[model samples]
Target chain A: MTDRPALSRVRVVLVQASHPGNIGAAARAMKTMGLSSLWLVQPKSFPDAEASARASGATDVLEAAQVVSTLTEALQGVTLAAALTSRRRELSLPAQWSREAAQTLASRAEHGEEVALVFGNETYGLSNEDLRVCQLPVMIPANPAYSSLNLGAAVQVMSYEISMALATPAALPVYGEPLATVDEVEALMAHIERATTATGFFNPANPKRLMPRLRRMFGRIALERDEVNILRGMLNFFERPLPGSAASTIAAPTRDDGKA
Target chain B: MTDRPALSRVRVVLVQASHPGNIGAAARAMKTMGLSSLWLVQPKSFPDAEASARASGATDVLEAAQVVSTLTEALQGVTLAAALTSRRRELSLPAQWSREAAQTLASRAEHGEEVALVFGNETYGLSNEDLRVCQLPVMIPANPAYSSLNLGAAVQVMSYEISMALATPAALPVYGEPLATVDEVEALMAHIERATTATGFFNPANPKRLMPRLRRMFGRIALERDEVNILRGMLNFFERPLPGSAASTIAAPTRDDGKA
Candidate 1:
């Protein structure tokens, strides 16, 4: 139902899957990531109730899956196939981290080439012949001490990475007001300088790089417009002179362009 | 057992998880990613045989998991907490993409701050009160049409992202042979020019941009030493004269340095 053109060309192929639940879970994983293609190679069971129940809302993916007898048949038109393995084997190519493998596959799929991400059985991974059939070996980096990832979890992680690789970079969310305008920032800087001078925290006569340091610090904060208004309001409250203060009338200079 | 110090400080808190199997799967996911701390708040069932069976080799994590009565108790010492939510809610902050949220949490954990990644129930996600309790809302980008990620699968994706964020940059694997040396490449270019001219493919009198184009193309290939040797061997075969042609005796010029 989603419009993921590249993902549509990327298929998830599970080889000799034993547990039907895992097959169902993998279908759900692929569906969540906008991938619909599924290929099964000699699964022990199919059209089982366990799989349907486990697939939850993604039974559409399971119902439409292609079940084939062998891995070769499953990879009919795949231009790029990545074998998901946990370790490096004798004649296998150097294992790529899943993220990099996903990127490579995504680029190929984006260019209208069919690609497959193949996973082996839960107990024993791909055989030597199966590894040789694929173009690349991909590994998910895990704790070396305990590197056993559940079959369904592995599928979820790989699917998630592929979705991320194919997605357009999204703009970071802005929680509140838009960023302060340049003029607003400059005005805030001026107001800060005036308040600091009146409070005797910063002496304009001996201003020792304080304004420059403040400017650098504020530049990093990237304040929102609302944040700027709040700061200016605080400054105004601090600047108002007390009613009976000694020559509160002695106005702090509004601008000290040269010193600032 | 892992050397992941930052990951050790991350706690996975599951609130009111309904299924025991999902609990076990979450534990396995956390252990695979090097995160050891797990907190369960009011789970429907725990220490069940089904949960233990599903945990597979990660029973150690489940055994060590702390069961708390409330979310506040689960979040006792946490400094930064991210609520894993699938959608934006009424009073919640703008949701962060899971990758950025992982980076933020990882940095804080690296600085020795206790951080928690909180997940809600399978049927109903974090309540409004639970979401408000956490500092940030995190979302995993998914298909708009079918964004229902299973509870265990969400844990797997989040744990993978956190592990990736905490991991040091890894060097790409190197295959069989070393890269061709600069001298070796230059010599191969020289040999190529000699062979091409001898074959009458390039005439020194009107050599226009061919050698430069070849050099530019070769620069991109980054051939290994073995590949360079193969190319040179093929050139040598092509350059050998046929048995007894008329002026096949006329040898090709050794070098066309000026024209090349």
Candidate 2:
């Protein structure tokens, strides 16, 4: 406990931030709220004197920040990416309110997942292109009349939400046993698709557009580690073994041939 | 709820110790752990040169500490007092393991009963006379082999225990409405005693013996504010209603009626 920390397993990425000073201020806010992993994506100006000066005692965050060229580069191995969006996007990604986003992101972080909360430029929020790139646009609710929150305030709100969640461990239900990890989730979807291609969940001729909807529901639950294992265990039971089909396997079922 | 502290209330009392510095540290612990209204009975020194310095940023607590000449004086007006003992005590009224004692005292504190937790002197714990004054001798379980904790640490443990009991009352019963406050408890006790004395459940001439035992039983449940009001209402129905019969009155009851 003495080690306390700069919060681990999560990173804050600000994209195309116009001011170096805002970067410093953002760093200060993150440190105050016990978050240190910061990522700068294609900042207009960083490593500037003004930005570092405003950072105050949060020089550690600035020194450790990873400046990347693109948002995709900022993400790579990230399991969950939440884009900060000011306006409504046309794409049908799930729009999570603040508390929902923070809790979901934090739960992922707890189980050693790389969760990236990506912020857009100061002048304009995540571009529609960036929003499309994100898994979800995590919205910050404000007075609709004037809902522009300063960059630092946004970081603080997210930090506060996550901190509260961590402090109260038993807030959420234990949800069966373990939640499915990204890999397990992918495997489960692949198995489901392979098994029922004739009756596709995502039909191509007149695509039903059902898989994305399923993803949204599962994502909302903020699945935990054990819960994932339980789910995968259940899914694996229904999954075709090895060759994916009983007939295709060495120990293939003769029932289909016998019926024919 | 905001204006007045709950009826079953917590009265945190610090004890005499070699160093005056720990008094402030104890106060800080009490404040953060959500226990306030400190009582200091015969500290080695008060308003000491080093106490405030060691208190860190918690000066308000040190400023509010009540310096009493004796433990009895501190216990006076206190209906339920728990003498926090690190080990065991010579004169024990009822044995209170930390959780038990904390719930009992915190319930009384909230109900507006004069509840108190008395810590001991630094080097030597509470005196036999001091222990005798407490209705319950609360022993905080630490590492039995290496259970030597500083006065501040003792206070912190007691405070944390009280907080746990108050924060979530799972130990009491399934989802209670809420715990009563000190005022509510006092009112209920007064009303019950009034009706009991009239109906001869308690002998008006000498109410002492039955009253203490009744208080003991009531202190155990950790009743919520509403529960206290309910009990008080029942008592009020049995007894004659007076200006103070509501039990919502904030004033401490006079006339001990301890002779019974």
Candidate 3:
């Protein structure tokens, strides 16, 4: 096939998929649509026969698929990632229909921006925690009566749509600053967690929906690298106390990593 | 689920399919798209364990499928049958890209015309004979280098397209006399065969490409019932010996069915 730079930049992340055959079939689906990058987050089995048999001629994709332990690791350098969620969640970014989401992902990928399409397990689907870090929510418009498409079929449809969108990619508005990488977003979330705990605004012991809400808010922002830096700086100031002030008299909690 | 008259009118026909598992997967695909009618033409095996296992929750569709011995039998009562052919053939009608065909099928179904989407065996897609009878040809646009979609995947994509089209049907021009049913077209072809043989215009003993060429020609016309009647009437008149002409003394070939 001709070089599809956009397809090459898009990674398919299967998170905690239990069925090895499904993983293999998904590999085949990806390859058939000209996508090669495959990231498996905590798959139950990697080189099973069932998966290879299902993959048919696409064993190459399975053989080269990257196995990671976490969705975060799977999304390492991805600038834009969409969580494939069929159900409505309490606080996810408004889900874009598969075609629209494919267009968005394809547009970003056309500009050489690394993007990911994340799929959850066959049974449980993506946990709220898993949906939290992804910048977008994507849903396939299937029959409401029986919308449960097999994992492989879902991958096939999404990949096919993305390939179609790439053929006539819609121009996306370029941001002044590059979007924050997955790692940058993770780091900012970690910093916010620390700052919130230190300031006693959020109690770690009673951490209920606070972190999830914050994650959803940040995910919706599609934070740029500069925005991440500015946010982290503000968080640092909030965590630090003024010298000779009453707040300074009280010692801050110490952590094993040395940052208070 | 609420009634989707268009979906109800559509039937998925698998012809001489070899894989029982693919049969089951195709059932699941149909059900997910709200399509229930399934017609199997000379399947290698049915009611098999592998097929049921692959069907998951869609065993209902498999259990209700109508099994027949030939594509013609499967397409009975179908006003519009599209032969899903990925490969180009010499005498087949121009294949419509899948989405466009779906809109065509959906529009007819919305008007209460029964339609069928026919797929052939995995190894040797639709035979020339099978392609000749269907009114339309449909092709799913996949990566050209690896357009070999698995039987189940192909069904899934086609079903998906039809379902999507049904949701937003395009206004189609209504025609008089309604389209000829598959059986009506088959009868017309049989009459033409006899008429051509009687007039010494076509030698079935050296059939080569005559029948297929005629089938493609008639298929492209989307013959109306009245048109089929008129054509068959003309053939009947031509087949009859000219009054007091020397041709009356010549004997027409006898057949077991005794049409002559």
Return the top candidate by TM-score: 3
For every candidate in turn, the CA RMSD to the true structure comes to 27.4, 27.9, 33.0
TM-score of 2: 0.38
lDDT of 1: 0.79
Q: After superposition, how far is residue B25 of candidate 2 from its true place, in Å?
A: 37
lDDT, candidates in the order shown: 0.79, 0.61, 0.80
On a 0 to 100 scale, what is the lDDT of residue B16 in model 1? 97
- Cα lDDT tens digits for candidate 2, B32-134: 5555577787777889877886565566768877788888877778898887776664435658677678788767767777888888886688888778777
Off by over 4 Å in 1: A169-260, B179-260
lDDT per residue as tens, model 3, A1-260: 35787889999999989999898789878887889899999999887999998888888889999998999999998999999988788867888988799999999999999999999999899988889889999987677877888888888888888887876432222224477999999999898778566545557899866667556546745666766775565455444443333333333333333772
- Per-candidate DockQ values are 0.15, 0.01, 0.07
lDDT of 1 by residue, A42-108 (tens): 9999978888988999999999999999887787767567899988765345568999888877876
Docking class of 1: incorrect
Candidate 1, residue A141: Cα displacement in angstroms equals 1.2
True contacts kept of each: 0.42, 0.00, 0.21
Give all TM-scores, in the order shown: 0.70, 0.38, 0.78
DockQ of 3: 0.07
lDDT for predicted candidate 2 compared with the true structure: 0.61
Expressed as tens digits, the lDDT of each residue in B1-260 for candidate 3 is 34787898999999988999899989998998999999999999987998999899899999999999989999888999998987666646667877788899998898889999999998899987788889888877666667667788888888888888887668875865477899999998798677555544557788766677556545655667766665565445444443233333232333333783
